[model samples]
Target: MDIDFIRGARLDDHLTIKTYISEFKKASLTFAQEIVDQEGVTIAKALVKVACIDNVKMKPRPFLRLS
Candidate 1:
């Protein structure tokens, strides 16, 4: 995970978080995320990578497709 802080959020600030997939692989995904204030000013951004795994087999697995 990597994050860059563009601005600090104050205690009274109303913040919104948005996230979306930036890359999709056979068994993993990379996500892009951002934090913004009520007025739509970006305060932070992040990139996160996550792997899909089969719990029973303890191995990498392809992500399920939703209808």
Candidate 2:
């Protein structure tokens, strides 16, 4: 929305665009496994995707909103 953010988003988007979907999917699953182990609960795959997307957008644990 702001200049700095716009520039950052452009940078991040450029970098993100280079990522292979399969790799992202693999990493997301691996990360979700760690979260499941730490939380001691099985999380739905959709949640894992959401969490992964949120994280790539920016780390979510620090300011996680369930909705």
Candidate 3:
């Protein structure tokens, strides 16, 4: 999994954050998040990508089956 922050936010300012799944699968998920200040100004954005591996030796892979 990897998380990247695209903007900087102050530590003392009140923040509102929201996250939503952009894509989802049995073995993986992708999401985006946004952070805003109290004034409703966007202060930061993040994209998170995650992959599932069954074992340590197994390479990362995507979802193969859906239920």
Candidate 4:
């Protein structure tokens, strides 16, 4: 996961977080995310990657079908 802090949030600030898929692969997924204040000011951004793995075999595995 890689994160960049654009601005600091104050104690009284109400924050909202949003995320979406940026890329998809057979065994991995990448995500784009952001944190914003009540007024829609961006406070931070992140790029996160996650992988599907077979724990028993200790190897990569394909993601399950959504539908």
Top candidate, metric TM-score: 4
- Alpha-carbon TM-score of each model against the true structure: 0.82, 0.14, 0.67, 0.91
Overall lDDT per candidate, in order of appearance = 0.97, 0.28, 0.78, 0.97
Please say which candidate is ahead in lDDT: 2 or 3: 3
Supply candidate 2's per-residue lDDT for 59.
50
RMSD of 3: 3.6
Better of 2 and 3 by TM-score: 3
- Cα lDDT of model 4 by residue, 1-67, tens digit: 9999999998988999999999999999999999999999999999999999999998999999977
Question: Which residue pairs overlap in candidate 3's backbone?
Answer: none
Candidate 3 lDDT, tens digit per residue, 1-67? Answer: 4455655677788888899998888778888888888888887777787788868679766567748
lDDT of 1 by residue, 1-67 (tens): 9999998999998899999999999999999999999999999999999999999999999999999
For model 3, the local distance difference test gives 0.78
Instruction: Output the worst ten-in-a-row residue range by lDDT, candidate 3.
Output: 1-10
Q: Name every residue pair that clashes in candidate 4.
A: none
For 1-67, candidate 2 gives per-residue lDDT tens digits of 1111222222223222111122243224322221122224422221124234453666544323368
What candidate 4 gets wrong by more than 4 Å, as runs, is: none
